[model samples]
Target chain A: MSETAQRRGRGRRPAGEVREGVLRAAADLLLSEGIKAVTFDRVASAAGSSKMTLYKWWPSAGALAAEAYFAHSEHQLEFPDTGDIRADLTAQLRSFVRLLTHEGERTREGTGSVLAGLIGVAQTDPELSAAFSEHYSAPRRALAVAAFEKARDRGQLRAGIDLGILVDQLWGACYNRLLIPDAPLTEDYAVALVNNALDGAAAR
Target chain B: MSETAQRRGRGRRPAGEVREGVLRAAADLLLSEGIKAVTFDRVASAAGSSKMTLYKWWPSAGALAAEAYFAHSEHQLEFPDTGDIRADLTAQLRSFVRLLTHEGERTREGTGSVLAGLIGVAQTDPELSAAFSEHYSAPRRALAVAAFEKARDRGQLRAGIDLGILVDQLWGACYNRLLIPDAPLTEDYAVALVNNALDGAAAR
Candidate 1:
């Protein structure tokens, strides 16, 4: 076997398997050490892949980090259809806050820090910026929107309500706290967000 | 007088004057060139001050950038209490959206970009992080909170409302769009955010 082939698992593993390994390694780095730790060299070494392979798959480090974050968060961030919008929203947001903060026995440690770093770097990197929205935010937001639509159909929500604003209020508030961090991003805060947003702040 | 004194205009400029000039120069670089261009070398040359002076005033590049952003935006981001909560919020949000987007005859080209860059860098920079919240976010948030309290006093808002969520819902949505950018952060969107948060989405 060629040295290159031997280096890349002696041509034994499938390309898809290799890619998954790469993503797993990258996610581990992101969750453990934050975004700055997901370098080409580190990810390549961790995944037993070459820098060339990483470059071929992702346009930039930020892009790779973005995908890694989505991969790591995909299952954990799903909205449950419990037929109660308030309960489901409250549960989902609590889970999200834990994921961003001090979740136990999961992708803890630097998850929020990693996310903040990815967001920070995305401002300047076009490929990373697009990857973040396409891979993560858009899909995640669509899930919330679908859940809200179901609730609306079931008469849990008011008619003529903009579902997008619902997204901006609840989830966007978390993002604000994550980015700016002037207030505590606790589960209680999440529950308060859901309740207040649904109940309205106007005096009846 | 020594050559060094002559170079700095023979110490003709006061320390306060030098600091103000440095801030102006840093803000200009941030607005026009984004965060990367506001290095000590670049800022010192632009402000006609020494790198030592910049370091004496600010701990890091991110720190300087944070203060510069606050200095530039102080006048533009104030909340006006026009006696009507909805109108006041809508106007404030519209103005904010314009500031982040394409307003003419102002800091038009890259205000949002600079803010995004600052927020991004602050994630990894302790000095920048503190400076961002201390100089920009905390003070700015205080302005909004005061206005909301006035409206609450006037019985325009429901009692026992979470004011932080109000800030998050309106401005946080703006920040979310700026960061994740799945949808438009337009004036219409801003108005909708304000109206919906006040009116809410309950079927009752």
Candidate 2:
């Protein structure tokens, strides 16, 4: 029998339940006390699980933190798809900005800080960096890419436009403002960004 | 007498020399050993200065690190003022990308890692964040903004373009790629990014 099955046969909690509890504990520690506090010992104790379980599942603190962070933020990546490309994109970007700036109601407070913490740790942790890109960044990027491609196919985007670069322009601006915190990510800023890219910034 | 004169009268090295030495040591530690090794004591000893001197001038490790990092990178921010906006902007961005990716001859290897380390720490260190934005980000952003404004006055940019947003798009795209590391930042990417921004992405 698998370790999970053996644990279940021994009348301990199911493997999935234990994983969920551990993740929840990790998330709670991350959100409440920052990334530094979410150590294996603390998480295991908080989740009522063994350190062996966490180690078996996640190889490092960063890996565990990445998974917890992803679970906390997975729902924020839902991009809207209205028929009008401009309006659709504007709304999508506005929502993204709201989330990044912690202005959205659905997102928990301090999400940005938690994310920034993960980003910092991920810089040195190769496994965490790859996991963050795969689980957190790729899906959201795909949503925007899909939207741009759809607009292109429907004859909305100008001919010869590189959709990848276009998406980069749109999202990159938001991420810049978000990361720097020098400027506010207001709704107007979002609208202006989308319009600027769509309607070229050059003088006629 | 000023503080520098008093310190000199007391047989201590001049304030300027002390500050420079400390910064040099901090930069050396940051570049050679990474952020973790740049503690105040380490920097002071490395510079042959005292911890009291480092503490007197910079309030925190992050602040000292920011100043040191900025000093090392200040020359890299000199954007050109060639009349051709596209070419000028492309050259500037290409150089910026090369530095961020640690591909430039002038930029040391592992520069990206140092930068990423600073960014990670800055997320939680408000003093470092402020100092970085003030000493590092603001000046470079101002350079880009000035270029765009000059281009607009010369009829290079299309009318009704928001210069702030345009600059953000240009720099932000590079930053996003830098932070994510999912995409390679090539010279062609720089050229294409500038071209896309200058020319509208909409179907003409």
Candidate 3:
């Protein structure tokens, strides 16, 4: 639903503390043991709580994992919005690549392992899918869209190129690099992508 | 480990028939029940085998899940190389997008879910990475690179754009689309990507 709904529902003041603890434990389990290890029991044990406590809050392992990943990673990512469109976009992307390559190892796993599991879980479970769309997918997507819109406003993007598609192109490279063998997320590669996106490839 | 060595070690006989059986069971479980429902006992029971057999092959549940994913999805992908660089690349990319979007629904959980999870697994686990690379990532990468090379040979590309980085930018879009919540892959988007890669973005 809404951020307010997630922020304030069910219990009183201590709920926030309990939720944070649960998410932390889930993240820990995912990093140390991978996706399969983040069971309700494991999360409960790690959080020094019970399975009921987790289920009451998260509803499923995927939800718990998604929240934990966002909690851990969102802070690490700061979207730069300098007036200069090219410089700002490049800097933000470089930061993202560096984070993916270095600081955000577990976060990457959280997205891929736990969040992916949640998406798969959603395919079979309608309740999980709704939860995922609201809590995990939408917020992250909105941020990227907002960034592109800002870029367009600054006159960096061409008139016809779909912003959504452009975002996909930029992100595809990162995911491909991460998934492929011996694929390094290099500055040269990143620069080429940015340049290509800014100016279309029609032979001059 | 050489393919020859691996094959010779297995002695052209079923070295780990029971283990393979468990993996098959795990694959089935992953397909039917999603990643969350897969269990060691269930896999063993489904395969008409024992937990001991599974343990001998895979150390943990994630490991089992990862292997099951590789076994199921590794064979389904192929990167073709037609003489028409643009058309072949488009066809190949379209196939990949379809897999990521459609088969992704069916096999993603079993394949261990998420673009990031796949990458993380590939990084730490050499066998899994090699399998992922050989079967999925490398072949497509090589195909795309070759397509660009073919285009260059035919004088279709500009003089300065790095082919390696260009391929990454094009394929990167696909990866980014799947990794995040973006629009579904369409034929128009694929064409645009091919056109962009072949010719520099600057207008003629």
Which has the higher DockQ value, candidate number 1 or candidate number 3? Answer: 1
Docking class of 2: medium
Best by TM-score: 1
Report how large a share of the reference interface contacts model 2 reproduces. 0.73
TM-score of candidate 3 relative to the true fold: 0.68
All candidates' TM-scores?
A: 0.92, 0.89, 0.68
Per-residue alpha-carbon lDDT of candidate 2 for residues A1-204, written as tens digits (9 for 90 to 100):
999899778869978889998888887788777778889999999998999989999988778988987786544677777778999989888776666666333346635667777777776678778888988877777777788888888999976766778767988788777677766667899999988898878776
Per-model DockQ = 0.82, 0.66, 0.28
For candidate 1 chain B, the 10 contiguous residues with the lowest summed lDDT are: B102-111
- Cα RMSD (angstroms) for every candidate in the order listed: 2.9, 3.8, 8.1
What's the CA error at residue A108 for candidate 1, in Å? 4.4
Q: If ranked by TM-score, best first, what sequence of candidates would result?
A: 1, 2, 3
Between candidates 2 and 3, the one scoring higher on lDDT is: 2
* Model 2 chain A: lowest-lDDT 10 consecutive positions: A103-112
lDDT of each residue in B44-124, candidate 2, tens digit only: 888988788778888789889989988875346677887888889889888767666654343466357777777777877
Clashing pairs in 2: A157-B203, A158-B202, A158-B203, A202-B157, A202-B158, A203-B157, A203-B158, A203-B159
Candidate 3 Cα outliers beyond 4 Å, as residue runs: A1-13, A27-37, A74-77, A103-137, A200-203, B1-84, B98-126, B196-204
What level of docking quality does candidate 1 show?
Answer: high
